[model samples]
Target: MSIETSEPTGDTRSRAAIKNALGEQARALGFQTMRITRPDTIQKAGDRLLTFLADGRHGTMEWMEANADRRRDPRQLWSEARSVVMLAMSYAPETDPMEALARPLEGIVSAYAKRADYHDVMKVKLKQLATDLERETGDPVKVFVDTAPLMEKPLAQAAGIGWQGKHTNLVSRDDGSWLFLGAILTATELDPDPPERDHCGRCSRCLDACPTKAFPAPYQLDARRCIAYLTIEHKGHIAEEFRAPIGNRIFGCDDCLAVCPWNKFARSAHETRLHVRAELDNPPLADLLPLDDSAFRARFRGTPVKRTGRDRFVRNCLIAAGNSADRALLPFVAPLLSDPSALVRAMAVWAFRRLADPDAIGTARAEHYGCEQDEAVKKEWDAGTTT
Candidate 1:
């Protein structure tokens, strides 16, 4: 719904009226809450981010380092941006996400990714709100949905939306950790809300719950050890140390988010677009193991997992198969030893050895190792023979 332009009263009262109208419109567009803050509200966030990058904990995500200046402050992102509107949408699972962890044969996708790409879903809503803001204030606005160099979590906290919990994700008292954040940076001035303070005092469930000990301390994440990073972002062979701990998670990790005690308040998403699609709800490892390029694209198109590409996703599935020890998956995995992507082939070797007996490993290695051109896959073949 578009806002009707009206004559401005005093500056404070005009901004207040615009904020109230925007709040109503944001709710109509399926956002859980909307709060306002200034572009300069998060000065300390810049310093904290610098430390994170200097420590090299961001792993291979070099974009964070390159965009550090813009991310440090919203003013640097857009010089004339006078106010930021931080918004939240819920994507909480209807069922316990932990239940999927026990379904070892089924690959576990992070709850948020079981639907279409959130960027596409939320951006449409944000653009509508941006149009309304432009009409009411007669100012240009830019929208973001976890994209670009904007530091959304800090912006959310500054806007009174939530606080950064020990897991370093924004956690709301009302919404728990199930929020997807979006922002509107406008050149118009709006009243700012009081910032939310950290409520994670004495709570370490999110830290201790990590399978790979990705947290070196409360609130600090070592992304290199994070399962989400290993499965989705890290392109090379996953370190052998992390494979078993990765379990059945194919696309991302939800352990830290799921264990937050604040989640007891989280409700299933009110927006159907944020709900898990039926096809992705219980993706069996058996079905996922053999998806070739075209079939993979056809299966995962419009979903976040598709961006990782088939070879990388298949590599994650191979890790799950190796850890599964179901032996039933061996038939599906055997053909991948000759898979064209060296990333997939190397993982196929490791998975083959995990399920195959020594005699079976010797047989498979003799057939594939002789012709294997990739040095990494050759190492995997040799390594599997011993292990």
Candidate 2:
């Protein structure tokens, strides 16, 4: 395939001007860093993800399997795409992200979700970047954050943003795991940067810190066992074995990311809007258990927590409440036995048994148990009673 050379006029000079202008524009946009990368820089990442999907490790995230060709090659996503510009934003917090686990009894929100949803925050930046590029190059462009079928981690890795750590997340030697990734696909063929090399050698901090042992191997993850997947992605009853390990992680989990030694180099986030809200940071499980659907939506608006919805999120809270052993939460747990959503009711019944008197369990079994018709609920009730 032959490549187009300069027009011998000013187009050649204009393209160079655009490339330099892009870096200057990105720097002015508060992006911690940005790099343009060649298309094939991401091929190895595609191979790794394809292997992961082929082995069925992605679990219920069927989109990963559905977009095989597009994810493996950026050209397949958009034929006009000539280069990918990967951008990174820092979200590092002042306090340790892992401190929530010490309480074990308090709910732990993922650092990314602790503030506003990153999709909302990063999408604005991505759009601005794309708009600037389009204006300069006079060519069409598309922007993507976590929303598109494109492989973000791989592209970010290829663009010299960072290497994928053993935890399988893009991690910068400068920013740790506290960065959010964004990308802009443009038709202009910009100069590409050299890719970063893997620096996770012999380090097992992330692997050893996982509560659920979600990593089956280095640079691979099993979503089925990940707390983040279970709490937010996997609906219905959580697996029995993982409940204890989940602790009070009511939304997504960050054990692996929080434990990395590279975090010492991370700077605290300058965006005050990304700071943790006092109400949500380490909130007690009891405060979250009784939020009705509308209340839940109202509370989590602009937050990533809204994705789980009331029923699924409350179900997660009930699991934490059951494991709390506080006994005080039983009163809060009892009323949900008749929650309209069977998933909620099922978890409530389990919480009741965990925090209720054995006699109360028997009484609940006799009076309110018939209200649950879902097979999964009935099974949890039966198992709880037997235990």
Candidate 3:
């Protein structure tokens, strides 16, 4: 429905009353915090995004460049959007995420992906909140999760829900770094909450903790060097330089987020659906390597990992297997050397090279290298033989 721009008459509800009621509804809908801000509040976000894109820091994400205008300011997305209601939901892990990194044999899925996909979870709640606001205010509304063009972190900060930290992710003093963000944009006029200030002082714990040094400076990220980007976004072979530092993280990297000192105040996720599943917490790389397309889909059904598809997911597993240095996984990694996808075959060769002794490497090289038509896989074989 189109928005009604005309001012409400004497029968209209008070804006303060609506805001209070919406806050209560938000909490009941599983959101931990909610705040409202003007659509034009994030003026600087566009410039920063342009600079990041101009420097080629966004990597292969061309969509960011395409949607730059709408992402910079919410008003550009919807001219009638007067107020933006930002919400945050916590997904803090019960156990330490860093501990999983030490066990190289197991793939470390990011804490957020260990459970149900937050996009699906948060989208449902956002729709419900938007519906409630429309029922009360008779205003047109639009809701967005992570996939939308809107820059959520800047909007969240503008609404006083959180501040953007040096790690370049939103950080709440109450919920810390583990919070998932969502937004509701409405034509209805509402008082904007006080904006959050930068709480990160001289502490560079997030920057110092990066395995690949993806951050060029505080509050900026270079996506090409980021493990999360390599594993989740970038397709094809992960560069040799990043493979070792990627460790066993198969999905996304949480090194910077995990190291933030502000997370001390964080509480475990209140939503039962967001809790981690036991099987996915620290799955063995060996187990993941055997999953065919069907098995991979069955394993990650309803999770974000499924979006990466079987080839890329197993390719990540192969990288983990290579870094694992576990000889037992050699048997598991061997069969994939003949897999159909060049991406999978290439990664398998990499894993085999890492785990196999000279004799074993020679045997596999002799068997597969002769028939390997893909130039990339051939390079992997040559590299393996030389190494």
Q: Which candidate achieves the best TM-score against the true structure? A: 1
Arrange candidates by lDDT, descending.
1, 3, 2
Q: Per-residue lDDT tens digits of candidate 2, residues 1-387?
A: 111233331465655656666777776776788888876667777888888888888888888899988888988989999898888888887788778767756888888888888788778867877886776567788888888788888888888888999999888998888898888888887878888889888999999999999999888899889999999998768878888788888999888988888888887766556767776677887788889999999888888899999999998998888878888888789889888888998888877887888898988888875776788778877885522
Better model by lDDT: candidate 1 vs candidate 3: 1
Q: State the lDDT of candidate 1 residue by residue for 272-312, as single tens digits.
A: 77778877886999999999999999998899989889999
Candidate models: Cα lDDT each: 0.90, 0.82, 0.89
Task: Give every collision pair in model 3.
Answer: none
**Per-prediction TM-score to the true structure, in the order listed:** 0.98, 0.93, 0.96
| 163-192: candidate 3 lDDT, tens digit per residue | 999989999899889999999999998888
Candidate 1: Cα lDDT at 113:
91
State which candidate, 2 or 3, has the greater TM-score: 3
Clashing pairs in 1: none
- Worst ten in a row by lDDT for model 1: 2-11
